[model samples]
Target: MLDSPLSARLEASERILVAGAGGGFDVYAGLPLALALRDQGKEVHLANLSFSRLESLDIDAWLDEDVAVIGPDTASRDWYFPERALARWLDAQGLPATVYAFPKVGVRPLRAAYARLIGRLGVDTIVLVDGGTDILMRGDEAGLGTPVEDMASLAAVHGLDLREKIVACLGFGVDAYHGVNHVQVLENLAALERDGAYLGAFSLSRATKPGALYLDAVAHARSEMPDYPSIVNGSIAAAVRGEFGDVRFTARTRGSELFINPLMALYFAVDLDGLARRSLYLERIEDTVLARQVAAVIAAYRDEIRPRPPKAFPH
Candidate 1:
């Protein structure tokens, strides 16, 4: 039997922070991992790069200039707030209700905010969770789906001087809507494996407790925000429940055909430092103060490079 490095890494840490790399319900994708860690007597916390307007939050809601503490009652005007909805679900389930939220700012402030949260929570380990594998893309990929926020989170966490730092990406092909090529995603993973940064992959099984809870949490979140359910998580949840091939739940997938297959339940893990080092453009945005600046840096890099032509997965 192969010993799992991902399990060993989690076992080595006492205080862990599992954060959503991309905004929205990306953090929900971490629910299973976080729950597993907690069951092992590790103190785990949840957070996200928020899609909600943090500015709308009352001054008291802020943990600092960049981090906000969002509980069940936290106020927000947005129709879609995955953080608060997740909080409510947690509260109802008798778990911790507070979900930390950070503005989708540039590397500079986002890094600072991450540092503050680590200090406040006394976190020794950080697991940056990306709902999709786009975070694994090196700049030259034919389609790096919505890399802005994902890269921002990766770059920001890379700046942290933590003892244990890892990244876990779920919902494999869910980023297709944003144009991520799965072939390029696999190629990047192989490269990371060469660098010894690939932590190994695991799949979620709805038959287990963590997997069942993940399905419940995702369903509860979707129920809480019926008007704007998360397509990424919805598809992941559907796949986890053993659904496949264009299975639709919400109207979010009305037109597009979806392949809700077993692969979507798989998680590809990697070490944050090696992953960050592999990035061709993260250094360019390290000094940025605004989120748009990070986007600009990526755009400039993309313009300068000749991306590999998109390749279809040859079955």
Candidate 2:
């Protein structure tokens, strides 16, 4: 089962819902996973913040064939559909679904609606993607930068404690504004206590092929590369053991900077792997050390914010 492909994970879930910010990234990542679930006879729902100005597009044509080429308007950046619309659509469906959110998702009412979805599902897992991790770490554009506080609020509203929750941290991609990157933040994971609930991190490593690497080739062409970060396989192997113990915390093992929606799908894929190993539950409280680490980083950033002395002392 360790060598089983993503299809296996999708097949295992009775019902699945893929959610993320709409964009090329999501189409590339999340859509494939949702289609995989559908292929396996599992009820699947795909939801995202809209980014198309086409009013509405045909979903069937987009996923007509394996690795199909979707039209431009299906995920154009100019469009910004509200999350509430997706939530309403899901509520109407009346089926089990997992809502995934990415970094800097500030649509408050959408999140609230998702919390209600948790109650509706009763027994379901909520996967917070790498982008959401960014929001959790740096707070939002409004300067409300407390992840612990936010999680606490969500827990209270949902009547669930995070420490007991299966919180899977998708630990790849170097995109600072949306993904976890700072070394200090990564180091602090050692202190986190998800109670007995599983808290795991994953990072992909570059592949060893017979030719120049893809990232190197892109760099030579001066083309933009995706934000996903890479590490030595040994390092990832070690971190996996350290964080998850005997449990396997799966990573793509393919070096790719993932876009928003796909990143959410990857979160579910890995979470499914962990779930297969052992059942993970939500605890009322996570480790207090998370608070200490947050304070330390905030203080470090605060120091950076300190006013500097005048170039020359005043007379």
Q: Which prediction has the highest TM-score against the true structure?
A: 1
Range of the 10 consecutive residues with the lowest summed lDDT in candidate 1: 1-10
**Residue 221 C-alpha lDDT in model 1:** 87
Q: What is the TM-score of each candidate against the true structure?
A: 0.98, 0.36
lDDT of each: 0.91, 0.31
TM-score of 1: 0.98
Name the runs in model 2 displaced over 4 angstroms. Answer: 1-13, 21-41, 49-108, 115-123, 131-171, 177-181, 199-315
Give one digit per residue, the lDDT tens place, for model 1 in 200-227.
9989999888899999998898789898
Task: State the lDDT of candidate 2 residue by residue for 1-315, as single tens digits.
Answer: 444433333334564545433222231223223443455675655434323342233444232211111232234233333232232333434432222222222223334444544444442433332222322232211222234333422332234322122223332322333323433233223323232222433222233220112223222212121232222211222332333222221253344432222222123223322322221111222222233443444444445543222132134
| Candidate RMSDs in order | 0.9, 14.5
